[model samples]
Target chain A: MSQAACIVGIGETDFCRKPGSGMSQLALQLRAATAAIQDAGLTPRVIDGIMPFPNLGRAEQFAANLGCENLRFAATIHTGGAAPVASLQAAATAVNAGMATHVLLPAGWNGYSGARVRQTVSQDVASIPGGAIARDYYLPFGFTAPPQWYSVMARRHMYEFGTTPEQLGTIAVTMRKHAQLNPKAVMHGRSMTLDDYLASPMLADPYRFFDCCLETDGAAAVVVTSAERARDLAAKPIQIMSGACGQPYPADEITNRKDFFRTGLSIAAPEAFGKAGIGPSDVDFAMIYDCFTFELLQQLEEAGFCKRGEGGHFVEGGRIELGGELPVNTHGGLLSEAHVLGMSHITEAVRQLRGEAEGRQVEGAEIGVVTGWGDFGDGSIAILRR
Target chain B: MSEYTKPLPELEGHTKDFYGFCKQGELHFQRCSACGTWRHVPRELCAECGSWDWEWARSSGRGEVYTWTVVGRALHPAFQQSCPYAPTVIELEEGVRLLSEVLDVAPEALEIGMPVEVVFEAVTDEITLPKFKRVAAS
Candidate 1:
C-alpha cells in the first residue's frame, strides 16, 4: 500500500437553517455518503472503511445503509468540529497501513432543528463538551453557550493586543461578501457591511451577532483513498499532503489554560505545515474554521499566516478577500456558509483544488489549508494540494 | 428570594468537597502535595505531576479578573431575566482560574486584571456557588 492519500470525492446536502428538510440525521448522512461514493465513480459496496462523526450515527449503521459488503476499517473522531479535518488523518493512516482501500468520512448534525446549543446545555450534562466544568462553573453564572465561552478569549485578545471590533467586523463582512457568490451559502443573498456588522446586536461582549456562525442543519461527506488508487478514480484527486490534530492543556475546560490566548491550532499548525514540507506562505488559500470571527483571526495567527497579535492587521486591507494574497473561506465558511461542522470547509478546499468553485474559485490555486476548532480549544489542520 | 431557576452544579464525587467548602463560606482548590500545584473544577489526580495525593487547600478568596463577557442575550431561559450579565473568569492569587460572575459591577466597569474577592452565593439548599466582587482599592 502506498503511504500517500488523496481526497477522491466530496458531497453535501442542502444547507438549511430549520428542520423542514424532513430528513432524519441518519438519512442526511447516508445521502451525503451516497453522493460522495457516486462522485468517486464507485458503488457503495466498494467502500471498505467508514469514519463517522461521534453522536451523529454509528459506523455499522452507516455501512449497512450504504450497502458496503466488506467493511474493513471503522472509527469515529470525537474532537467536535475538529473531527472532520482530523478524520483525514485517520483515513490516510488507515489507507496507508493497508487496512482499508477507501474510507468514507461523514459529518452532519441537526444543529438548528434538533438540539441547539441553548437547548443542549439543559438536556444532559454528560452530553455537553466540558460537561463537568460547564455544569459546575459556567452554567451557574449563565455562561452557557459558545459565544459566551469564547468571548472570554476574545476580550482578552483585545485587551492584550488592542484588537478592535472593526477588525472583527472585517471578517464577518468578508465572509458575508463571499457568501453572496455561493448560492449554497445560508446567507448567500444577505450582504453585510462593516457598518452593518458594527450595528448588529451584541450577543456577548466583543462579539456581535454576525460574529457567530449560523446554526445550520446540514451534512457533508468525503471519500479518501490512497493516492496510488486515486489515479484510477473518476474525480480529480486532491492530495492530502499532511494532517494534524492538537489539544491545549486541559482540553475540556477553557478558563484553566495557562495561556488563555493560545489555542490548539498553535500546536497543530506548525506540525502540519512542517510535515507537508511547506510554510503558510506556500498556500494559495485557507479554509479556516470560523466558528466565530475572533477564532478565525486567532487561527490565522496560530496557523502561522502571521505573527501572534498581528492577525487583526493580517486580515485587513482586503488581504483575505477573493483574489487577494490568501483567499479564505471561499465558500463563505461557517460564518456565512452553513455550518456543517467544518466538513464544508474540507469540501470547499477540494472544490478549489479541483477548480470546481464557480464564482468563488481562486485562479490557479494549487495549495490550500483547512482548519477545525472544536470543544474548548481542540484544533485540527489539513494541508491539501492539487 | 425567589426560587433559583437556573442550572445548578451536579455534585460529583470529585467536586462535592469543593462545593461543600463553598457552602461553608470558603473557597478551596485541590492542591497536589508533591508538586505544590493548585487545580480547580476538582479532579482526582494532579494534572501537572499525575499524583493522587492531594489536599483541599483553602484559598484567600481574592483574585483578579482575568477576562469576562457581558452576555447581551441570554442563551438560557433562566438568564433571560438577567440579560446582559457578565460571566467572568477570575484568576485567584493561588494561580488558578475559575468561572464566576462579578457581582455589583457594570459590564463596562469590569476590566481585565481588576482585583476581586470570592463571595459564596447559596443558590439552593444543596448548592452554593462561589462568585466574586470587586476589591476596593486601598
Candidate 2:
C-alpha cells in the first residue's frame, strides 16, 4: 500500500471582519496559494494538481493566476464545511495514485464585505437551488438559515439528553479563551463570560449571539504532496493518515435523520480511525469544527470523545481547554478564530502536530484529528500525525 | 386574520402531489407500494427497496411532537412580525416525520412527545399550508 500523503505547507490571510484589500475573490486565493507554495519551499511551477472545496473558487482560475506551470489534476468536492477534509481526502487519493506530485487546496470567502453578508439573514441562505430539501420542505416553514436548521438538533439534544445551555456555554467560553492566544482570530482579545453568553440576545432559541460562528472575510490554503516529497520540504510533514466524509441515513434533510442528536460523524469517525490504524484514545488533541458551540458538543459525542449524549458534561470543568485533555480548536476554531469553511481547523491541526502552534500548542502532541460538520450534519474527519 | 407572510412552498415535480393534497386540507405522504415504507419531502424512489413505485397515502394528521425549535429571529422580511414562531417536526403515526409550523400554542408550552393534529391554513388564494395544533389531553 502507498504511504499516506503529507501536508507540506499551510498559509492563511489576515482573518478579519473585512479584508481591506480591493482584491477580487480570486486574488485573495492566489495570495494564500502563493504563500503556501513558498512555505513549502517550492515554486508554484511544481504544483501539478489542484483540488478546491467545491464552488468556493474556480480551480482553473487559481492554477492560472497562481502561475502553476503544470496543472495535471484538478477536482472539487461539495459538502459545505465538510469540503475541507473531503479535499484532503482527494489530495491523498490523487498523490497516492501518482496523478500529481504537489497538490494545492485553497479556500477563501468575503462573507462580511461581500453581498453574502445579507445571505446570513435571508431565508434562502445556503440552500441548493432547485432542490426539494430547502425550497419545498424547510423554507416553507421558516427553517431557512443554517442556525435555524441546526437549532432543531440542539433542541432535540436538549430534550433527549437533558443537555443544559451552561454545558454548551462551556464550549463557547473555551473557544474564546483559545482565541485570546491567537492574534489572527476575529474575536481575539474580546473576552466572554458564561454570563455574557447567557445575556447575549437570542438569534435563534437555544442559540445566543455568541453561539454562532463569526461572519469572516479571509482565506486559507494548504499544500499536499507525497510523503517522500514532504520530507524534503521546509515544514515538518503532517501525515494524512486517514480522511473520510460520510453521512448517516437521511443526511441532507435534518428533520428526517434517524437520530437528531447524532451527526454523520458517528459513521465517519470509525471509518477514519480504522483507516489510520488508531482509535479515538490514540488522539492527543483535536480541532473539532465549531460553527456553533452546540456543534462542538454534538461532534464530541460523534467523534467518540465521550459517550452519546454525554458531550454536555464532557465539556464541563475545562476538559477541552488549552491545558486540559484533548485540547480542541487550539487556534480557536470557526467559532472564535475564523470561518474559512473549516480549513483553518486543518491548518491548526498541522500547526499542533508540527509543534508550531506557539502559545496554544498541545503539550508534546503527536497525533491529532480535525473534523468538519455541514449541510444538516454531513460530516468529514481527517486524522493526522507528525 | 392576515395571511401568513412566510414564503409558501413552490409546487413542482414530486411536491405537486403533496401540495395538491394540502390544497384539499388533507395531509399526504408517499408509501412505497413495493416495500410498504413511508417517506417524506415527496420523492419518487422507495427509501427501503429502491423501487420507483409508490402511492399517496392520506395522513391521519394525528401525531406527537418529536422535536422542535422556536426561531426567535426572522430569516425573512415576511417573518418579521412572526418572530419567535416554532417550526417543528411532527412524527406522524405513519412513522415518517414532516416539518410544519406549530399554531395555537406558546413555544414554552411545546414539549417532546406532546400530541398534535394537523390544521390547514390558506396563506394565499393558491397555497394552503398544513400546520399543527396542540391536541389537549383527554
Candidate 3:
C-alpha cells in the first residue's frame, strides 16, 4: 500500500475577530494560503486540489478569484465540526490514491469581538445552511444557534453522569492556563475559579457563564501532499496515521435523541483506534475540541480515554494540564485558543509535531491526536505521529 | 401556524409514544410484545424485536436521571427567555429515555440515579412539553 499522505506545509494569518482593513474574506484566504505555499517551499502552481469547508469564504468563489489553473479536484465537505479532519482525510485519500498529489484544506472566520458584534452578523456561523441538524429537530425549537441546541447534552450529562459546573469550569480554566502559554489564544491568562464558574450568570442551568467556547475572528490553513513529497519538502514530517469521522446517527431523531449524553464520537472512537493501531492510552497529547467544556468531557470518555462518568475526576485530578499525563489543547483548544472553528487545532498538531510550539509543547511528544468536535455531536479524530 | 409558546408539544394527531393516558395527563411508551423492550419516540415499529407489532401502556413517568446539561449560552430565539435552561435525558421506569426539560430544582440537587417523575409544562395552547421533577427517592 502507498504510504500515508502527510502534511507538507501549514500556514495561518494573524488572528482578528475584527479587522479594520476592510479586507475582503478572499484577501484573508489569499494571504494565508500564500503563506502556506511558502511554508511548504512550493509554488502555488503545485496545488492540484482544493477542499474548502463551506464557512470559509466559499470554495468555488475563492478558486475563481485566485484564478487557479489545472484544478483537478474542488469540493466541499459538510459535517459541522468534523469538516477539518474530514477535509484532511479526503485530501490524503486523493493523494494516496494518486488522484491528486497536493491538496489544500482551508477554513477561517471571525466569531468574536468583531466590528459587527451582533450575533446575526453572518449567515454563516461555521454551520451548514440546512444540515440534518438544522432542517429538522433543532430549527423547530428555535435552536438556530449551536450553543443553545447543544446545551441540552451538557445539562443531561450533569444530571445523569453527576458532572458538575465546577468540573465544567475546570475545563475552561484548564484551556485558559494552556492559552496563557499560547500568544495566539483569545482567552489566554484568563483563568476562572470554580466559584467564579458557579457565580457567573447562567446561560443554561448546569452550564455556567464560563462553560462555552470562545468565538474569535481568525483564519488557519493546512497543506497536504504525499508522504514522499513531504519528506523532501519540510525538515519535519508529521505522519497522518489515520482518521475516524462521521455524523450523528441519522435515523435517530434530531430532537428526540435516544441518549443525549452519547455522541457519534462514541461510535467514531473505536474505528479510529482500530485504524491508528493504538488504543487511547498510547496518546501522549490530545487536542480534543473544547467548543464547550461538556463536549470536552463527553468526547474524552466516549473516545475511550477513560470510562464513563470518570471525566470529572480525570479532569479534577489535573490530568489535562500542560505537564499532566495527557496534556490536551496545549494550544488552549477552541475554548481558550480561538474558535475560528476547529481548524486551528489541526494546525496546532502540525506545530507540535514540528516542535515549533515555544512553551506549550508536550515534553518529547511522539503521538498527538486532534479532534474536531461540536455542533450537536458531529465530530472527527486525527491521530498524528512523529 | 400562529406564533404562541406552549409548555407542552401538541400530542393530538401525533402517532406513536404517548399512550391514551398522556392525553389524560400521563406519559407512556411502546413495549415489544416479543422482547419486552420499551421504546421511546413512539415508533411505528418496535426497535427491539424489529416488530411492527407493539403495545402501548401508561407509565409511572418515574425514572432516574440519565444525563443532562444546563445551557449557559442563549442559542434559540424562542429560548431567549429560556436561556440557561436545563435540558435532560431521563431514563424512565419502563426503561426508555426521553429528552425533556427539568424543573423546580437546582442544578446541584440534580444527580445521576436521582428519582424523577414526569411533569408537563403548558407551552402553547395546544401543547405541553413533558418535563421532570425530582421524586426525592432513588
Per-residue alpha-carbon lDDT of model 1 for B18-85, expressed as tens digits? 89999999999989999999998788888898999999999999999999998998988989989888
TM-score of 1: 0.97
- Residues A263-339 of candidate 1 have per-residue lDDT tens digits of 78889999999999999999999999999999999999999999989999989999999989989998999999988
The segments of candidate 1 whose C-alpha lies over 4 angstroms from its true place after superposition are A1-3
- Candidate 1 docking band: high
- Predictions in order: chain A TM-score: 0.97, 0.96, 0.91
Candidate 2 vs candidate 3: which has greater DockQ? Answer: 2
- Tell how far residue A282 is off in model 3, in angstroms: 3.4
Which lDDT tens digits does candidate 3 get at residues A71-159?
Answer: 78877777766788777778888888888877888776545544332255212333433343232223333444555556666665665
Q: How would the candidate models be sorted by TM-score, starting from the highest?
A: 1, 2, 3
lDDT at position B106, candidate 3: 72
Model number with the top DockQ: 1
DockQ of each: 0.82, 0.70, 0.29
